[model samples]
Target chain A: MTLSSGTVAPGAPTRTATGSVTVRALRLLESFTAERPELSLSELARRSGTPLSTVHRLVGDLMEWGALERDPSTGRIRVGLRLWEVASLAPRALSLREAAIPVLEDVAAVTHENVQLGVREGDEVVFVERIRGRRSVRLLTRVGGRFALPPTGIGLALLAHAPADVQERVCAGPLRRFTPYTVTDPVRLRAMLAEVRRSGVAVSDRQVTDDAVSVAAPVFDRSRAIRAAVSVVVEADTGRPAQLTPLVRAAALSIGRALG
Target chain B: MTLSSGTVAPGAPTRTATGSVTVRALRLLESFTAERPELSLSELARRSGTPLSTVHRLVGDLMEWGALERDPSTGRIRVGLRLWEVASLAPRALSLREAAIPVLEDVAAVTHENVQLGVREGDEVVFVERIRGRRSVRLLTRVGGRFALPPTGIGLALLAHAPADVQERVCAGPLRRFTPYTVTDPVRLRAMLAEVRRSGVAVSDRQVTDDAVSVAAPVFDRSRAIRAAVSVVVEADTGRPAQLTPLVRAAALSIGRALG
Candidate 1:
């Protein structure tokens, strides 16, 4: 989540409002990102655009509740383990991850390729878990990171099953171009989604990066509604998407059954 | 985390204080547990001791900020994926898990035993990650769960290197017994800690359950401060703690080096 100054607008006269205090506290947390996991008090105040005094009070409340922690050696602030424990109860991420890990591990063992699980969030795909293959090509994705829905195998599988509005919003593009192989045209992207639904698999050959290709399949819940997508990524030149299709599809099925 | 009405005590007249709003928001989140991951609005209000009106407003703000989500099918509130994404940046958990996963995977592949990573929190050990062994004994632990720091091997390893005050406080009694083989006596527990320090490995033979035993070793950061613990658990009847000691220790060292 990106930190925004609009969370506590300067011109708003209700700075001390109880509701705004809660919003300010949450925004202070938003200030800590993967890039800057640790921040000093002044840095947090400046980044969050809150007054120093307000930041100090909010940080104290957060620390007392264990939402934030002070680093022992550097004395900088960081996201706390207590918060992670509570957030682990998130069913969309945790339940899906629990059901998919065994299947993903099996695929990773056999292929020695990157295995990933993702779900569509709005017009993007949010990765829930990833198992790095020992000798696989380097990946730009990380757990909890987001990527555009048109450039990844997992994204395509999810977009294929997404609602009409979501699909249209994504296909009505400013589709990002990661590599020359990335399909950016709105018409072609829609065609690919249709192909994904028909074939029950999606292939992104060197779309996200020039060195890697991924094969993905959709996972369904008990109601037969698409719940998640699973994929395996490997070196572009050596990997065969056709050969990987059945394995990926089977893994998705097993995960869905486990979820049920 | 346990939810308590004490958060917004009825006896305390400062219920409308700005600070209390932040506290109330957090306590509402604490109401969510692994067993009851989703709850209705009235359940949340009743559990948190906040009035339904207050819960309605707080839930609105929280949902708007993506700290909470409503299930599409059930209409019950659950922890949001966005919160999990933000909490994923908690350095104590995330950085440690990233460093140890490769080593833990190797150990799991070789032994087909449960491999776990944990860190000390106050007087408890909070599990950060676990890789289940297909053929291993069923464990009572889960990721993000907390347990007392005396009965399990990972807890023992962490307790051995904990500060003097923490060690004294724990050894001062009330060590809850999990099984007949659990070491609850303060004298015996102290002796076990000393042995863990001397040998650089801890063995808990059926301390947590009648069917399992584990061997754990402490992982240290660059400053030589104990940062976490890694362990392998297997069936007690056929598992050999002595045979697993070196493998667990080496994995710990490799993880520590990776952290550096």
Candidate 2:
């Protein structure tokens, strides 16, 4: 079974006929986003589109389970540490991070730049782990944050190895542009994908941000299946993408080996 | 409403009287632990004590929502990345990690050891972020992993600043010894706590592990509240705890400032 396309499916609790209560509770959680991490009880009810009574009951249960915590001062609620602890057991994120950290440390030691490990999740890249270098350029990306697959080096690297249908779907346009350098044209993006495939490396130059450039390489598991990508982001003016390419690729390979 | 000191409350779904379906479903998730990340359908049913049919229905909803994912080969289920993404927004974990990463990177660069940032949760310490140096000693702890409050440097640092009631409860005994060098005596532990409070640092030498030594310091938020703790673990016999002490303390302070 798969969730409907929208966050709250038709016949969801918001309407007269309620769907599963589990679905309604999960929708309440989904309402809390990066921009709005905390929400008052009424705000949660409004955002989740559930009635206040239902929201209060569900929130009470969630709070008791430690999946939600109330602020001492404001009476607002946020996701709880216990929830994070349980979620940390997710193999896709934490397991991969555990395997890749040592290799990432090596890459960071050499380049002293932001190092990231990401896997393709649908059409987006979800950063599983990131090692911020001591003197590297600042990045907007956060661990577990999502970004478009067309504009990031790790995204391009993962996209270059993605299935043909997925590649086609992503290249069919409506691509969001972060900067002028971001390749929004499907035709241009297709060409870049081919080049990345050929070279086994992807360079995203000032695509996500004006001052940052990232070099990324795909990682293969024991079966030689492309599993993930690793990248190193540097200041655009540094102009050392060429020098950093091998280092990033080597780290990716080492991580793949460790995953075995 | 507080949960009655166990994973599930007294009126939880386990009894003949069923609780909310949503709470029951969430309990299925709480059943997953570090020791058992993956669970077969039957195992999930048994662990959660939900009827097999009910488990089937709830698991379907969870899987559809991407809160639970099935392992391809074994058909076992595990926590999903989507859930981790949502949980990552928990301010107690991600926000603190975001502020601490840079300072941690600096500590890693200088000491090249395992640097950790942790917050107290109950009587234990939950490591929010950990940067393992390239040549650091192998550690039993992982990011999001928990350890006893008496043996780990971060744990000691956090425990030192805990409320008097919490401290008394913890020091009241049954302290598990990880190694022979571990401090199991409450009186000695209290003295060590006093020293940590006075010096704003905690050192655990060959306590949790036989071959490792760790130095830790308390982190103060803008309110001057002891919000977290930072630590660096190195191999024993290296005898540089004194040298690493200041570096870890400084990083903790820097992270606290960044948190503001």
Identify the candidate with maximal TM-score. Answer: 1
Share of native interface contacts recovered by each model:
0.52, 0.59
Each prediction's DockQ against the real complex: 0.42, 0.44
Tens digit of per-residue lDDT, candidate 1, span A62-129: 77678899888888999999989999999998888988998998999899889999998878899999
CA shift of B173, model 1, Å = 2.2
Candidate 1: where are CA atoms >4 Å away? Answer: A1-19, B1-19
What is candidate 2's CA lDDT for residue B183?
97
- Per-residue CA lDDT of model 2 for A1-260, tens digit only, reads 35233433444332334446566677678889888989988899899888886677677768766788875545689998888998999988877887898888778777778899999888999998887776689787888789999999999999999999999999997999888898989999999999999998999999999999999999988887787899999999975888998888888889999887
Kindly list the interface RMSD, in angstroms, of each predicted candidate in the order they appear. 6.3, 5.2
Q: What lDDT is obtained when candidate 2 is compared to the true structure?
A: 0.84
User: Which regions of candidate 2 fall more than 4 Å away from where they truly are?
Assistant: A1-18, B1-19
DockQ of 1: 0.42
Tens digits of per-residue lDDT, candidate 1, B1-260, equal: 22123432343332345545666677789889888999998999998888886677667657767788888888899998878888999999888898999899889989989999999999999999998887688888899989898999999999999999999999997888999999989999999999999999999999999999989999998899999999999999888778999999999999999998
Q: On residues B99-133, what C-alpha lDDT tens digit does candidate 2 reach at each position?
A: 88878877877887888989998889999888777
